[model samples]
Target: MPVGSITRGTTNTNRLRRVDRWIAEQPALRHAADPFVVDLGFGASAVTTFELAARLIRSRPDVEVLGLEIDPARVRTAREQLDRTRAGDGHFPAGLPVTFGLGGFEVPTPDARRPAVIRAFNVLRQYDEAQVDEAWRRMSARLAPGGLVVEGTCDELGRVSSWVGVTAEGPRTFTISLRRSGLERPSIVAERLPKALIHRNVPGERIHELLATLDRAWRVHAPMSVYGGSQRWIAAVATLRHEGWPVIGGPRRSRLGELTLPWDAVAPV
Candidate 1:
């Protein structure tokens, strides 16, 4: 457990805003009486955890959030952040619910209370690819029924990202979100894929094949370049659906440089 010294303990103000927004829109946590979310490996600061609570409370007012960190020092740092942000009314935009605790993948709580969402971004990136599946299983096993585990990576600036939406049942979907400008290729996000699929971005891998398909579609849709990158991405996604990629959602999400697909389409084969 203490094999690694500790993570770099890095975090930003709104590093995870997009994932928070997406989670807030989901039906699972919308009606939860005391829907609890956990920010696993919250690094040295729990700002994003607080931000997640602030945003999600708009939809599920009864929700509470807890930031979990493995490093004792990082936990102390998060406690300090809590002290600074001290939530009451204006702590959040409109009085959101939030809190934090110290725990690991085991969640180490006597109450045995599993959370509704466990967000672990940029956490597993430090581990080898082989370690990903076991880590995911260990964490997801601690989720409440219908709970989700969002595991992924993002660029330093949070512009381009990809994550896996895993439920207690197993992994369900994969979503890639990006900013539209200066984006060379949709596969550029391959670099941001979760640990499970990052190294799998090679020939003979499901994700590799999928990204290659998207790249080819992007090239084929190059004629639509004048319409804007978003439009070109939309066309490329359409080509994926036509080729049986099991793509989900419509132009609404695609317009925002997002592409969602069923898990098996890109699941490790």
Candidate 2:
């Protein structure tokens, strides 16, 4: 299936750093026998994809990263740039191995190998919520068993964001990433969550309930304000887990202003 149409082709160098960082941490990518990450909808510039490759290599140095742009022109431009970068000198700026391809969510490849990680950041925000499930299904289906499909959105400056990690089976986890000091409250992530849940952040939806609960806990931990926003967020998230939100990760991620929760905690209402 073609799956969906191309997006607005918008992108920035660090636009997806948050999600890429999470991808680096995922056991899905860490434990894969052959990790190939797809930068679906890489937009007019391929810098972000290059950055993603560098980031993933930090966690899994042998990882292969491919930048896939729906627009042929974009792919051509990216390939040209990569050609120039590689032709110039023995030193490519980022030093990470990378490739560019012309393709869409179906993730075209003549080799027919499934991707181990598909990082579709900012690709689905323009889509309807109804389209998300199908899109997730299609992308997830292209994953090798135990692989991951990470779909997410972030602020223009890469300050705040959220991502959903889906396996071939379905969504497995949700991770919110932010600049701890720049955030007013943990709930600020509501605006950056994937399209599937951003609109669902209301009265009865599970996502809505999660954000509401986070807000309440943030208030409950207001006294931590004396320490700083990061401390406050840590306290707030601790409260969420205490209240049974299925918090899983340790402080390695927590220190980076991230919290990973089991999918059940915020499963759709």
Candidate 3:
């Protein structure tokens, strides 16, 4: 049995697109010899796992994706869905490099081959904050050298999301992604911070400072919104970089309403 509880299983097609797109861009998956990826706690539907495999295959043809869920019933349903797809009764590509399994933060694999990347979105939101470190440790231990653990949360529509990228060395970077249109403020994403940093968003916290700074920058650039949300977002992110936030990526990523910072900048406390 897996070492976690069953979640609400609330998922939709492309509900994880932002994180999946980011994962496909990562060197951890793109450069692995035979990249094995895990979708930990992959809800009731295996569609996200299927989509993950589809996106990654474009970067690494040999990439394999396994959707692991703590709920046996969910695993069985996903297997059945895969079966339907295999039998030409479903929409997914037949025989894609995907599988469904039962596992949790421990990340059990049939052949015991460590995976190159494990995506655990929305999995830890149900646990107490203190359990996050142990869960990260367990998952990171199952990673192959140079592997990555992307853990975070996203809205039901997948339009807004945030995640932390952890390696064996510990958390490395934090990212915020949102749909460009109707973005009220960059700080709106603070609500979706990963379990490790959610509660720490109070006074005197690095994450809080980061969000406050971003809000200030957004206000300073509000006039640019007349042109477009993307323009305003790029301006705000550029301002953040100028003000020494160690923002990662550049105009291209920022134009997509995404910003990344070194994890040390906001690692709890």
Best by the TM-score measure: 3
TM-score per candidate, chains pooled: 0.90, 0.93, 0.97
Candidate 2 Cα deviation (angstroms), residue 153: 0.7
User: Which candidate model has the greater lDDT, 1 or 2?
Assistant: 2
Question: Which candidate number maximizes lDDT?
Answer: 3
- Model 3, 1-269: lDDT tens digits are 67877888888999999998899889999888769999999898888999999999898988999899999999999999999988888767897988988888889997898999999999898899989989999999999999999999999899989999999989999999999788777777878889888888888999999999998989999999899999999999999898889999889888877899999999876
Candidate 3 residue 58 C-alpha distance from true site, Å: 1.1
Q: Kindly report which residue stretches of model 2 are placed more than 4 angstroms away from their true locations once superposed.
A: 1-3, 88-95
lDDT of 3: 0.90
Candidate ranking (lDDT, best to worst): 3, 2, 1
Angstrom error at residue 53, model 1:
1.3
lDDT scores of the candidates, listed in order: 0.79, 0.83, 0.90
Tens-digit lDDT string for candidate 2 (1-269)? 34467788777767888788778878889999888888898888888888888788889989998888777789899888788777764235634678988777788764987889998989899899888998898888889889999988988889988989889999988988888775566788888888878887888888888888987987888888789877887888888888888887865677678888877777777
Off by over 4 Å in 1: 1-5, 31-33, 87-95
Pairs of residues clashing in candidate 1: none
